[model samples]
Target chain A: MSTRTPGTDDGSAPLLTLLPSTPGGAAAPAPERADAARNRRRILDAAARIVAEKGPDAVTMNQVAHASGIGVGTVYRRFGDVSQLLWALLDDRERQFQEAYMSGPPPLGPGAPADERLDAFLDALVDRVAEQRALLLAAHSAAPRARYHSGAYQVMHTHVAMLVSRLRPDADPALLAHLLLAPFSPDLMHHLSVEQALPAERVKAGVRELLALRDRPRPA
Target chain B: MSTRTPGTDDGSAPLLTLLPSTPGGAAAPAPERADAARNRRRILDAAARIVAEKGPDAVTMNQVAHASGIGVGTVYRRFGDVSQLLWALLDDRERQFQEAYMSGPPPLGPGAPADERLDAFLDALVDRVAEQRALLLAAHSAAPRARYHSGAYQVMHTHVAMLVSRLRPDADPALLAHLLLAPFSPDLMHHLSVEQALPAERVKAGVRELLALRDRPRPA
Candidate 1:
């Protein structure tokens, strides 16, 4: 349910994450199983707090269990290991982000013109990457090439490709989409936002400005 | 002479290597020793052939030694290791490329308009990457993040940033340079060219088309 598969159920998203429930959220609430759903929230929340406060490297099963006021055995049984728990945390946040861009509201969602939608998407992407900086960096470094093939990237690429076609029917939408998304790669975002110390607003603005070339005459 | 040092002469490029002696070939000749510069050329030529035909993964010191008809000990002494030899090959080609764009002729060099020069640079970059696909991919995967911090990248970024400033003085040239160069990333090119089987010309054309939005009035 919590795997990285995109465009699927996103595993009953917003069932218990921090995102304000959206239109596409709350897909026919599944019947409660033996796993305690409330306990899952508590555990995930505790792990997220640990990641935010001390970074992912600091999170341990014992710490998460203690922070959640749950037994260590339950933590182990639920997540299997610290890495899995960290991935779960990333998935949780990604699901929320998908909801916002896919169906949350105007500009970001379905109602705005393609140009504003593109702008809104880039802005939201900056915030999303900034919000999950530590987790994304770790994921990126672990499998740097995997970013091009990841579910999140594919979903974002497909979304961007559609918008590029809408914005410029004469352009090569597929390649242009990849070029547009290039700046948002986790490593670049991490470099600009953290290494270079540019604020999220400036980063967002810079990314948007890159698209300002969309209607110029291309050199032959 | 090149060892991947970021921004520090890239270690006096082309003291010895095999590149076609073109119009932009050869900086001021450096002081030479008794060991014929011809010998350095032979060794590098052998390495390049192996890399092209068998891929960089198949390269070895002994193989280069045998292929170059040089002593195995000399190969070790000259390159320090297999990785260093591969880098020398990359730098050899990179130096030629830098020479072409920085001082060779019209569009890619100094004579053309900024916009056309920008297009030429990217076109040549595509050709450069296509020529050294195997080598670049190896170097990139080995140290993916190093691209941002490398001397070659810094030099390229400087060139692109200057062009961007010329084209749009009011724009954020520094950041736009990074965004513009992002599509040339080794990983993405490897994905598109090798993995996706995209023709080099199409990839080059698609990349140039992305800049079509350059002079358009951005949406307020």
Candidate 2:
């Protein structure tokens, strides 16, 4: 197996580093000029609002520029294109989510048993995917294979693997984590939530049921 | 929720019916001329050989035609393009696999317990994916989300769901089947076996370990 971390090898640093806060909630490597940072924040915030209101397909550079009261050229300059802007929006949300899971509180973060934490994380993941379903499905469609190597997926895998290691010391935690996380793929989730019209609550419950399968007796 | 069987609703009848044996091992709806059937078998065999030796990328119309001793124009006339030919190959292999799990004797088919059948199906599935890794990856790249709705996926889902329903009467078998099948997605399997360089036996063992989780006691 490659010693390199899963997502670090992928060329996502440029996009990941665009925001002020890193995914680990570490300090920025270098402080951006206050005004430039403000413009970036404004632009990303505007784009996020547009995505929330009308879905990612409805987002446009002009609309974000107008919404943020920034020039269209500035929006173009900062994010390069609509795709990059949307990715930045995803990165932004991802950073916050990482913070919450890594350190925010009990269960999802710290101060809880590994099993409870695993449950909390999977539940939160369903919500996280739901919150950004449109963007995630778009990103997944754009590069299906990239998900396994992407920064976000790597982090999730590492975290889940850690919990599995603690909970089931005898199992292969890394491989098990990957399998556990498979059910949360954006495409599968989209089929369950949008195409099948399954409620998020039901989906979450189903996740718990899968976890509960651990307790079932082996078939004789 | 959809009253339809998963694979039947997908528009795969034309490609699937191209072969004499239906996925169910039932008689073909219509028979082809003897020479045409012979030609079709020759073409597919030649293509499969090329793919096995040189991978899907090396397959070409002229190459298959030359190898099969069929006219290039006939190859194109029967299968419109390289992409269609690949899909036909996949459908062909899928038909055989479907027969094995659906009707073939013993653990994978009719004679074993539901849990053992599920395990056999998953192990066989891992081999099936590995056998067609390059072709499956190419098809997946062409359309990622389509996997959920594809005829092959639907059939696998239906079969797995049936096993789950038999084993866990209290669980939502349909949803659990989808989740269990999620780990076998082509892209992820490619990542594991090709990129990660994990052996097929190891992957199979990992899958068995995942299923074994059902027998593990719940965490306190």
Among these predicted structures, which one has the highest lDDT? 2
Q: For every model shown, what is its TM-score relative to the native structure?
A: 0.83, 0.83
* TM-score (C-alpha) between model 2 and the true structure: 0.83
Worst 10 residues of 1 chain B by lDDT: B15-24
User: Per-candidate TM-score, first chain only?
Assistant: 0.81, 0.83
TM-score of 1: 0.83
Which CAPRI tier for candidate 2? acceptable
Best prediction by DockQ:
1
**Candidate 1 chain A worst ten-residue window by lDDT:** A15-24
Give the DockQ (C-alpha) for candidate 2. Answer: 0.34
Write out the backbone clash pairs for model 1.
A212-B213, A213-B212, A213-B213, A213-B214, A214-B213, A215-B213, A216-B212, B6-B151, B7-B151
Colliding residue pairs in candidate 2: none
Candidate 2 residues lying further than 4 Å off, grouped into runs, are A1-29, A33-39, A69-77, A212-220, B1-29, B71-73, B212-220
